[model samples]
Target: MNLSDSRRASIAWLFLCFAWGTGFVAAREGVKYAPPFLFAGLRVLGAGLLLLVICLLTKAKLPNRRQLATLLTMGAVIEGFTNICIAFAVFYLTSGMLSLMLATTPFWMVGIESLKPQGDRLSSRHTVGLAIGFTGMVGLLAPKLIGVSYNSHLLMGCLVMQGACVSISFGSLYVRHQRLGVAPFMGAAWQMISAGVIVVLVGTLRGEWVRWHFTPQVAKPFFYLLLIPSMLGYSCYVYCLPRIPLALFSLHRYINTVVTFLLGWLILGEKFGVGECFAVVVIFTGVFLVQNSSFTVSKKEPSS
Candidate 1:
């Protein structure tokens, strides 16, 4: 709580938030050139290799069989499914919509936790807030629903994107409970390696590998993915997760939606309407309320 320590923490958090916010943009940019699966595979594989090297240099121990299984599952959920689903969703929905939908992840976490015998109980306020948040999301997305004939293609994309967030929430809960007994970097390295391999294998089987071609325009974003979001951003996440409060970290999701929307608007020329604006404010406010409801009486006090 000393001034210097608090200052260091604040700086670290700022860096992490910036990285997380920009990471979505990096992924979106990378997918434009490379096949989605290929893009995800390469970024994760490169990050995995980098972290693996670091682990070896530090003499970190490898996981046991049980831990390995858990790591693989986490990989599938967090990196594998999350990447593929969001990529597919990107084809149909704007990044802003996708990000906004994905921000419901924390509510999913709360719902899951409530199912456990020893888990945190949800207040009635939290439940009401969750409903309001979902309502706002539907409002925000209603425009996309009009005039566009429904096809399995678009429906599947929406399903995949929502599934990705659910899977990530499930995987995060597993990590929170399992206690893998390794450093964040070590755990993250294994997860990325496993997920990357899976993505590459699936992509290849789906004929994505042969379809991938490298050119200057595409290559630039690919390299940025490998270095910035994949390596640095994920490292920051893994490092910060255990240190920050769970509810506090959830705010990052909200921030990410705003960041993605603004970036998409400025950089990609995605359009935003009055409905979208109102929906964003309402949705994010509800999310904040649901997430912070338990400690509301304290006003300025941070939620643990």
Candidate 2:
């Protein structure tokens, strides 16, 4: 690629990362007025519909039966289950904490991939990076660790956020393995639509839809989530995936976490004391180590 094209891709990826980073705050605000699952369902559904409209206007080819099935499965695990976990988690976890926990996704990806046939093996550097990353996680949870009996909710929230990470990592690996020939935008559209259907179904079954309310306050963040993060953010991610190395692209997670931490503090008045800040630094360092190590040895793969 030419330098100009590379620069534009970099810009797009950076914007996408920013949108994802800020989405935690948007989701946090959105759930305050609407039931979590229902809110998530609506947001994703809106984005899906918008993308489908774009695909239609552009005369994009529709996926075949097998592709549709794979996309739907990816959606269910990656977007559906992942968002539900985040929605539940934010009730007890700050947006910053949620993002920080998610930064562990690369570690999960590495560990899971190691188990796959022809997968990348963990180097000594990966081992140290993983150890450091886990240590940082422990640091983030120090307060809860000190008083575990009192912070069961926080513990559960952390666990749920980790579940989100695992789900997303698996989704990424699935995409890498499948190597679908579908257009990036088309694939994302189907995934969002499928996820929307699944979440809405779950929300209805759980009575979340019945409890949902629509008001101006909720609409603002809802639209932000739909247009900015779900639609545009993911579109940029898909566009950049084929253009960048997976390990190098994954470095965006650090930017995401830092942005989330800052936005949470600035906009939401979320607290971050010296210890928490230190933990963030530690986590970033560990993630950086992992990214650098992987860049040297990891094979390129598509991300979800």
Predicted structure with the largest lDDT when compared to the true one: 2
Task: After the best TM-score superposition of candidate 1, give how far the Cα of residue 65 lies from its true spot, in angstroms.
Answer: 3.5
Ten-residue stretch with the least lDDT total in model 1 = 294-303
Reference-based TM-score of each model: 0.87, 0.91
Q: What does the lDDT read for residue 230 in candidate 2?
A: 86
RMSD per prediction, one decimal?
5.4, 4.5
Q: Please, what are the lDDT tens digits per residue for candidate 1 over residues 164-227?
A: 8788888878767777786678788888888888788777888897779887767887777677
Each prediction's Cα lDDT score?
0.75, 0.85
Top-TM-score structure, candidate number: 2
| lDDT of each residue in 1-304, candidate 2, tens digit only | 9898898889889898899999999888888889988888878987998998999899999999998888888888788998788878989999888888888888888888887766888888888888888888888786665753468788899999889989998988877767778988888888888888888888888988667878998999999999898888988888788787787788788888889989999999998899988888887877777767852355657788
Clashes of 2: 0
The reply for model 1, stretches above 4 Å from the true place, is: 1-4, 116-120, 147-156, 242-248, 295-304
